[model samples]
Every structure is written in structure tokens, then in C-alpha cells.
Target: MAVSGVLGVFKDLDTAIAGVDALNELGYTRADFEVLTNAPYPEGTFGEEHGMHRLGLFPLVGAACGFSVGLLITGATQMAFPLVTGGKPLFSIPPMIIIMYEGTLLAAVIFTVIGLLFESRLPRLGSNLYDPRITAGYIGLLLHAPAEKVSEAAAALRRAGAEDVILEEQPAPAAAKAPQRKGASA
Candidate 1:
């Protein structure tokens, strides 16, 4: 893929807002850019759109699958081995309820954790455009556009009182690197 990214680092929030507006005027949409800040900023501070996530569905789907599996396991076990207790039915509902409840709880908890990780963008794949100054309370407006537009983005940022602008090309894919062997001779 073609390389394209311009990161504008600003000292104050107002400058960052101006930078965002500048990018917006340059025809960049909210999806084409993102704001990075160490401190919490209110939503729409940089006119960034609310990111969509399906965290809620994770637990519900997990619970449903867990409950189904629990029911199948319990029912199969009961049917496989006949248990005579007070002449009760072979597929007992009360006994199976406990296993189903436990399974549902366990899977829901696990899936919720997985959902959190997913929603949090854990185990990120690519080396993203970033600046260390953002961690030091600087706001960074990262704009991703075509290579042709990168210079314009950078100039827009510079005019918006950006402390500095960094243009970076995306690195090679991880698969391009040779695999290292353990305890191999140099």
C-alpha cells in the first residue's frame, strides 16, 4: 500500500482543535483522522466521531452458546446413563439448570473480557503514527490521507499553531522480516 500519514503535535487543546479544523477544511473526514491525548478529553473535542463497538453483543452471544452447550452436555449425559431416582424423568430439568447457569456465567465472563480487549484495540498489529510528546500532555492529531495530500495536511497543521508535524511512511509488514531461531549459531 502507498504510504500516507501526517501527525501534528500541539501543546494546547485549542491548537489541537484548530489543527483538526484545518484538516477538516482540507476535505478529510472524521474517519480519516484521529486524536491522541494522554488525558481524557470530552467527546467531539476534536470533532471525532464516536467509534462503534459491539461489546454488548459479545457477552450475550457467549451466554447463548454456553447455555446451549451446557444443556446439550447435561441432557446427553443423563440420556447415556439411566439414573433411577424417585422414578423421576431421565432428562431432568432441575439438575441441568445448575450446569447451564454455571456455563452461562463462565462463558459470559470470558467473552466479556475478550470483548473488552477487542474494544480496547489490544494486541495492536501495526506500528501506528505516534509521538512521545503526546504522552507528555501534548495532543496529536493524526491525519491519514493519500500521499499526495500529506504535504497539504502537514501545512494545514503547521498553520494551526502545531508545535511540530511528523510525516511517516508505513513500515513493511511483519511477515517480511525473517524469523529468528532459538539457540541458533550466529
Candidate 2:
């Protein structure tokens, strides 16, 4: 099914909040629309439902994997080539503690960064509901609605004092690539 998106630009935060409320009244759920702003705003600042995220698990899983890898590397190296120093026994705990600690910290930091990017929906591939005015301190409320409801959604946004509304039709499905002709240019 074809879908269309609308972006309602507002110059004031209050009007933007009203735009969100207007969309809500038009039978649009929080998931169907997103608020865009240039500055950081607390979640649910506009009374939108807080999105659930699983960022907390990333660090824990990374730490566990790092600890396991560290343990394996230390143990396997010691077991593979036995080295006697100061007549001490192999698989020494004191030295292994340092490597394991460092490994755990490194992996945890890496995973936290990964989780942050994932949670923030980075690299938005084909988002068409964006307006440059948003970067100029204007707030944008992007709404994804069925093709039939595009006008209705735009009207609702206008009622809420939207300064301008931008509409975009979702791209059609990609067509199959044309087959190369025999003896094509090298």
C-alpha cells in the first residue's frame, strides 16, 4: 500500500505541542508521528509517549563477552606455551586480572557507543519528511499517514497553527534492474 508523510513546521514550541495534540485528535498515534527539533529536549516533553529502548543490555552483554575472550586468551596462551618465571605456577591470577579488567572496560565502552547509535536511529536512509527550517530552530512534526488521509492530516496540522506543511509521497517499489546486453561495453 502506498503511504505519504507530512511535515508541519512551527516557529514556536507551544504551537508545535498543539500540532502534536491535533494529530492525536485526528486518530494518529504517537508512533505514527515524530517530533524533530534542533536542540535536545527531554523525552515526553511534548506529552508524547516515551519510547522504550534496550540500551541498558548492550554494556552488560559486551562486558560478559569481553571477560570470556580475555579469559580464553590468557588461559590458552599460558596452556599452549608454558613459561616458568620466578618458579611461579602457570595460569597466574594476578596478571590475568589486569588484562581482563582492561578488556571488560574497552568492550563496555564500545558497546555503549553502538547502543547509542542504534537507539538514536542514526543514518536515516530515506526520510523524506525533513525540512531545512527545522535546523533553523523551527520545530517539525512529521506524520506518516495513509495516502487517502494526507489532506486530512495536513488540515489538522494547519488548525494547530502550523506555519507551513510539506508533503511527500512514499517512493514506489524499486523496479528490477535491466539485464546487460551481450557484448556490452567493457
Candidate 3:
């Protein structure tokens, strides 16, 4: 479904919350809208009926998996290539413990960073529906409404003290190109 929308910019969280409440009172549902803020606001303040914040969870899970994998790799390597030193055990627990700890921590950090990047959809080279004012501490409430309801939605936002109501257009998808063959001359 071609999703068209309007974004209502507000000066602060309070104004944004008020605007969302007004829209809710005007028969707008939570599924039809989203709120973006520079800093996180309290849940339910902007008529956000669902507690759906899951961005942080990705890094935690990634870290756990990374730690497990790192431990397994260290243990397997130690078993496969035994190194006997002056009266030292072939598979020394103390030294191996240090290696395993470092590897596990490294993996956790790497995976967490990767997870954060993936979850945020970062490194996007294309433009997206965004307002510069949002970075200047303005809260933005974006509504995905029917084209016919655009005007009404904007009006509702204005009535609720929105500083600016702007229609956000989706950027056309870029055409896919064929991949070049490996080892081709530059």
C-alpha cells in the first residue's frame, strides 16, 4: 500500500503529547501514527497505546551469542593444537581462561555494535522522511493516513498546537543494477 503521510512538528514533548491526545480524541488510532523524538519520552504520553520499544534487545541477544561462539572457538583451538611448555599443562586452564575471556568480550562488543547498526538501519545513503527541526529538540508526530484524510490530519495536528504540519513524500526506490563479475578489470 502506497503509504503517504504528514508529520507534525512540536516544540517539546508536552506539546507533542497534547497533539497526539487530540488526534486520539478525534478518532485517530495508535496504528495510524508514530512519534519520533530526539530523546526518549515516557510511554503512553503521546497516546502510544503499545509498549513496542525493542531496539535495545537486539544488542543484548547479539552479545550473548557472540560470547558463546567465542568460548567455543577458543576451547576447540586449544584442544586441536596442544602446546606443552616447561612443566605446563598442554591445555592449561588459567591461560586459556584469559584468552576465552578476552575473545568472549571482543565478540560481544563486535556483535553488539553490529546489532545496533542493523536495528537502526544506519549507513543509509538515501534521503528519508525527516525534518531538520527534529534534531533541534523538536518532537515529530508522523501520521500515515489515507490521502483523503491528509488535510484533516494536518488540521488536527495544528489544532493541537503543532508548530508545523508538513506532508512527507516517499522517495522513489532506486533501480537495481546487475553485479559486476569477479576479477573484472577496473
Query: Could you say which candidate leads in TM-score?
Result: 2
Better of 1 and 3 by lDDT: 1
Over the stretch 1-186, how does candidate 2's per-residue lDDT look in tens digits? 667778888999999999999998988888888888999799888776676669989999889988888888888888998998678898787778888888888899899999989986665544445667788899988877888898898988988999988777445224323211111010
lDDT tens digits by residue: candidate 3, 89-184: 766666666666676677667767777787665654432445667877998787777667777888888888898887755442353132111111
Cα displacement (angstroms), candidate 3, residue 22, comes to 2.2
Candidate 3 stretches with Cα past 4 Å from truth are: 49-74, 81-92, 123-127, 169-186
Clashes of each: 0, 0, 0
lDDT of each: 0.78, 0.79, 0.69
Worst 10 residues of 3 by lDDT: 177-186
Of the candidates numbered 2 and 3, which has the greater TM-score value? Answer: 2
lDDT of 3 at 160: 84
Per-residue lDDT for 178 in model 2?
A: 28
Give the Å shift of residue 114 in candidate 2.
3.5
Model 3 vs. true fold: TM: 0.71
Off by over 4 Å in 2: 81-89, 169-186
